[model samples]
Structures are given as C-alpha cells and as structure tokens.
Target: MLLRKPAASELSAEPILSAAENYSGEMHAIDTGVRVDAVEFARGRVALGRLLAKRGIGYGDRVVMAVANGPLFAAALCAVLARGASPLILHAKTPAAEMRRYAERYAARMVFGDGSSETEYRETGLEPYLVEAADWARLLCANVKIVDESAGNVSLVLPGVPLHPTSGTTGQPKVALRPGRPAIAEAAHYIETTGIQASDTILVAAPQSHAYCYGMGTMVPLLCGASIITMRGFEAGLVQSALRDTNVTVVPAVPAMLGSLMFGTRGDLFARVNTVFSAGAPLNEKTAKAFANKFGIAVRPLYGTTETGGIAISLPGSQAVAGICVGPAMKDVEVDVRDDGQGLAPGLGMTYVRSESMMTGYLDENGLDQSFVVDGWFKTGDIANQDTEGRIYLHGRQSEVINVAGMKVIPSEVENVLLRISGVIEAKVYSREHRTGSQSVQAAVVAHGVDDADVRAHCEKNLVYYKRPSMISFVEALPRNATGKIDMAALSNL
Candidate 1:
C-alpha cells in the first residue's frame, strides 16, 4: 500500500495535540518498563504547560532543557511548546561548563532538568526550575485547565530564535535556531518520505537533543501517530533487546554506532528491524552492505543538519538504490550543488538547501539574522556531488577537506579506502598543518594487528599520491563527542 503524503495543514498544526488526536489509542512511548498512552502524554503536556506558565515562563522564553530521552523529556518538550516557549534541548551528558556556556550564549531565562542537573546549574550560578522524574507526574497534573491548543506566539518567535546547538567536529558547537513551522514541516516531510504510520514503532537510540533524533526519533513518529521506544543511550545489547522485544520497525542511528552494532558482539541481533535510517556522518559502503546482508533490511542513508531538521535527502527501503547515495531531496526541500570556492552551481562544491526545515539563524546579543545563508538557501557546508539522476553523494565537510599542494581531497574517500583494508576496524582522515608551511594529509586509524605500512599500502591501491596520508597515527580508538562523531579538534591536538 502506498503511503499518503502528509497534509501541509497538518504540518502547520500544533505538534502537541496532533499526535494526541491521531494516535489517541496507540501507545506513544516506552521508557524503561513504563508504557505511556497518547492521551495521557497529551494531558501531561497540558498540565506541565500550565505549571510552567505559572512559574513565569511565557512565549519566546528560552528554556534550556538538559534531559535524556524518556517520558519526562517528551513531556517537557510538549509543555514548553504548549506554553509558547522554545526548548533548547541540551545533551544531558554534556559537560557542565559547555551547558552553562550555551545557556549564557542563548541568554536563556529559564532552565529545566533533574535534581542533579539543577544542582549543577545552581553551581554555575544560574537558578533554574528543578523538576525530578518523581514529581513530573504531579507537576504536570497539578494545573488541568484548558489552554490555547494553537501553536501560540512562540511559533512566531521561531524565525529569529536560536533553539538548538549544531554539532561541530572541528570546533565548538554552534546554536541553530529553527522556526516552529520549519520544524513541523521537516517532521512532516520525514513522515512522508519514510512512509511513517500509526502502526509503525520507532526505536530512538540517538540523542533527542540532536536534529536526527528530534526529527526522525521523536517528532516524525509522534506526528505520524507512530509509537516511540526511546533508549537513554546507545547500547548494542539494549538496542538488540528493544528490536526483539518491541515492535520497533524504524531506527535512526549514526554510522559509527551502527557499525558497532553490525560488527560488535551483538552483530546478529538486528534481524528484527524492518527499516534503518543512518545519518549524522558519512555512511560507508561496507557498513551499508553488511547491514543489508545480515538483517535483510536496507540501511537508508539520509543527509541533513541541525540547520535543516532531519532529512533533506533519503532513500526508502523499497528503493533498490544502495551505498552512500542519500537518494533525492525530500518533498518541499531543494538541494543545490555549487561550484567550489565560487559557490556557483553545477560542480562538486558546497551543498545548499532551501527547505521548510531551514533554521532561523545562530543567536547572539544582536539577535538572530543572516548567518547561515546567502539568499534563501542554507549553506550546508557539506561537499557533495549530485548525479544526473539527482541522487546526492556527500563527500565530506568542505571545512575538513584536505588540500595537499593545492589538490583537494575528501576525507571520506580516504576513510572508505582504509576501511576496505583487511584488519582496519575504523579510520579517519584529516588535514594537519606541516612545519614546512602547507597543510598535509594525515590519517588516524584504529585496527587490530595492522601496522602503518599495511594501511599506507592499502591507501596506495585506492588513493592518488597527493591524497594519501603523509602522517599516519594508529590509535586504539578515535575520540568522539557526546553524539558519537569524530572529535577532529582532539585529533589535531594528538
């Protein structure tokens, strides 16, 4: 059966009540051993909204939410949205200094978290509303008055509000502000592209604070009336158990985490999942092929950023396309491949997206304005090539591209080549400043029983002379950030 396209009107409607009415009888979430119904979730959100309003939280207020993915987190997001406030969903595991910095950067007026987080925030000299899991039910149920179900004035503030942080592999994370409608549209597009349905169950192992989880993991399922089973963190064992125990049909994961699941001790446990969405970083061909061979399910590669909601381009399982192609631009989203340096079109340059999911902008005391775009399109900063058939293939971040003697090389190309090596477990390639004056190609590899000579020989077969790594360092493991992406800054220091 063909999945119907989501109505634009529904996309513009309030996300809080949309899932409630659509999936009223369906189970909405499974956190640990607790199962929450859609109706109960909606009521909780309403009550929480009222409670927050009473605490002086109002429309356009920035609420820094440092929490994990669970019933309380979902309720908090809904409550904030209901109260016409925007949620800056911070990673619960983020260092306190970074969290405090973000709160200060965004000029956040209110903060919400558990007792421990609240204590940490207080230590940082910010007095925030502290709500624990035990009291969340009571707090949300305290004020049960009917409030405006309309998306409220907070949605209007979205066009200029920086609400979330963009993960930076090479530098400090930046805040990306997305208007409410764009977020809703992105969620709607995700549902349409993936054919999400009320009967489908989504397993969210990714961090909800990130765009991938915010859209595919949380928003998409809720908007489409599908249930969500959220795991607080990514664990191969926990993921396997969820897949086998729950009716989890859809999963969104980063390539590294997916690689661990496919090649780790729990490799064979993902056979029950019907569809898998891989994103956050470049998805290599080996992992893609291995996942399909092992699970009889296609690993759908998606491309997008915090600046552009969940998926800008994606391929469905029904599609025969495979490997690192991100399929096509989603409906209501436009992708352009521009010329390098010039930023003009028809060459392998930077990718630009014009979509409903475009962020408002990065925030500052001067307020949000033109920081991410030239005209109407958001500069993706990702280097990609669009084929004649309109399929997008991401190479690597334009900023991370290695320039060896004026020759440009994408790290993903080198990384893919190294992964093909016999004993290589994982590989990352970057550019390092040489004492001789120019930047040289460097590679850090994680392998078992493989030496630098073996990796160089492997690279020799795949990469050109200038593209090969001049310096190769073998590490036990690559340093990754909270979101499981390679920490290039840390690598540079090494």
Candidate 2:
C-alpha cells in the first residue's frame, strides 16, 4: 500500500447530500432509455434512503455498491450518502465472491448491486439490495407521493462519504477513504473549473465507477444542473453515434477512447462538441494532434489521481507546450514539484499536491494507516515539471522509469517517439529484467505493417541510444485493464 490516512483530528466530515440536493439537471441512459430530472432523482433518493434504513444501514456503516452506470446509479449514490453510509463503488461486473470479499475486508454493513447480480450475491450467502432500472424509474417518476419521515429533522449527522479504489497499475489495488466535506469540495471545484452549465449535455463513455467519470461525468454535471448521457462502455461506433444523435457539448473520455476515435469517420462527428477532456493515462502527442487535425477540436489533458480527486486541468482552447500540458492548478488547489535530490531541474521532480478535496487515507485490511501524507503534501509518485507558463508536463510514473546501466529512461517519452512513427497505432515501453540483474528497455507495439527494424530506425533518429528500445515486439493489440489503462504488470510476459 503506497498511501496511508492522516490523523483522525485532521479529518472533517460533512453531509455530501447538500451538493446532490442542489442538482436540477437530468440523466439519460443510452441502453435503458431512462431519463430522470432532478426532481425525479431526489424522490428516488429519498425512497432509496428508506430502503437503506430498513436494511439497518446508517452513519459510519460501510456499504459496497456495484451498480452499473445510469441515472439509477447516480440516485443510489445520493441515497447512500443521504443515509450517512460510507459507500465503496466497484466495477459493475465484479463477481459476487469478490464483492463479498471486499465487503468483509472493508467491514461493510451491506452490499448493493444491480438486478443481474442479485442471484449470485444471494448464492454467496448475502442478501444484496438489487437495483432495477424499471424499479428506480417507478420510485422516481411514480405519481404516488413519497412520504418523508425525517424531512424536517435537523439532528441527523452525515459522516459517510464515497470511497474509491486505486487503479493498481503500480501494485495491488487499495481502497481510498475520503471525508464528505473534502469530496463535496472537490466536486464543487471541478464543476466551477469546467464551467458545466444547465444547458450543456455531457457524454460519458468512460467507466462510471472510476474516479474520473464518477466526478466529471456524473457528480460534477449533475451537481451544477447539467444533463448527462451515459454509455455502459466505450465503443467507437456507439460513442460517435451518441455524439451525432444527441446535443452533447462536453465529452469526457480517456486517451484509449480518443485514440480509437481516430480511425473512424469524423465528418461533422463532433459538430456540436466544444469541449473534450482526456485523462486516466497520458495523452500521446500523436493522438492529440490527429484528433485535433481531423475533428478541429483541442484535447484538454486533465490530470489527477483517484486519491487526490482533482488537482489540475487544461482549460478549453489551451495549447500543449512542447508535449501535452495539463493546465495550471485548479481553483483552491495547490500543486508543486519536489526535487528528488538527483540533480533534477529547479521545477522538475516528484509532483506533490495538497487540497481540501484530497482523500483522508487508504483503507488496508488491518485498519487505517496514516503515513502517506507528510506535513500537508501527498507525494503523487509522478515525475512532472511545471513550465514557465504554469502548465504541468508529465514524464511518467516514477516507478515506470527504466534504469539501464545507471541511466534513466522514461517509458512515456519512448512510447511517444514510437507513436510518431508511421502506421504505429499503439505503443507501450517497459524495462525488461535480464538474468544477470540488469534491466533493458523493451517495447510492445501495435502497428500496421511495421516491424522491429522500422521501430529501431525511428528510435535512432528521435531518442538517445540508451533511451531507445533494445527490443521491440509487434502485436495486434495492447492489453488494457478495466479502467482503460495499459496493464503494466501483464506487459513483462511480452
């Protein structure tokens, strides 16, 4: 576990429902054909609160939620918060056994999942709260007036907030525990920074379970009265179709999805889109330029981690200086780079950030560990530098840096060079360990009619000798995890 919690005295808890209550937007689902406005969503939230109360879920009790993305998921999130239950959201397809394990590991009071997962959860000896789209719709839009038992009560204390899981690219995944005040503060900052409006319709193709989509796609927009259109998963055809059919002005996508959109038709494909935000992984210059050249739109690189909520984002129409630059620190957020004491430049080193919205700590099996944060800053484990213009340029994960004969090689730098070569569609660079205890740079490439020689030749022209890939393997596709990030652990086998 790389992160630990701060002291309990440093944490402050507030009700997250205050933000949800301010939402006057709408949620539209592509697959389920369910449209819920703010009023409907609130009604459903209150009703769901009753259901959770019946299940004996309340303040400080942890609940595991594996519901799929849609209006219902958003409602369920709010309802869980309303009942003052800390909620941990997992991937919708997570097996019932794994869900139960996480529940036990986290000491959750109950598990909430979609209708499809009900039987499996029951078979696992857990009576899960099954959320059906039809049932949710009826709860929200039904004509029957929902009686509120504690609508006027002011004594309730909400200490529960949403929890997130790390992507585990560096190691095993750990759960992030956050306070309600910081979580709501982060959502407000994101909504204000992005300028999300009531009239704008945002398209969400990324996994809603992830922090990026959960905040930017669902919470940010809804909290500010902006509508959202969600797709269960990202497919080029489906996403493009939704963009063409709907009036989606903002599209928050990962780099993988943006790269996939490069091969398809783009004749007015993004006619109505004025903003596009990319995160989760580094946005290679190839895809950035290609998307801009083809669609006449600039790709804003948003930078943050699940544990940090949101730290920085390139505003609309910001140009990438040198490489891709995730713009300056967001409002009320402080960002800086620390020197590694290895002769790095003045403003270039490990990225450290601190904000009210950052997570309180990491949840381990034993209990809360409060050691990750030093003083007030959290080490982000990323090699980054702030340009003179105050834009953030990421090198790569510090753990992903390759050491060859005591020299350093950033994989993202090498991968970017590979992507510049003709016919190269995807590229991932890593360090390969030899039996003699030395590491050599290796690359896995997905390209069209490109071989090792072509890759080497390009590297020779662009990268230093040690920085160039010593070995290259051409494959049809790169293996990716559920969150659209390349599975670094699985790359060593290649």
TM-score of 2: 0.89
Error of 1 at 232 (Å): 1.1
N/CA/C clash count, model 2? 2
Tens-digit lDDT track for model 1 on 121-166?
5566655443333333432111111132232222234411327776
- Candidate 2 lDDT over 101-151, as tens digits, reads 777666665766663345676677765444333454322110111133233
Q: How well does each candidate superpose onto the true structure, as a TM-score?
A: 0.85, 0.89
In angstroms, the error of model 2 at 343 is 5.9
Clashing pairs in 2: 5-369, 5-370
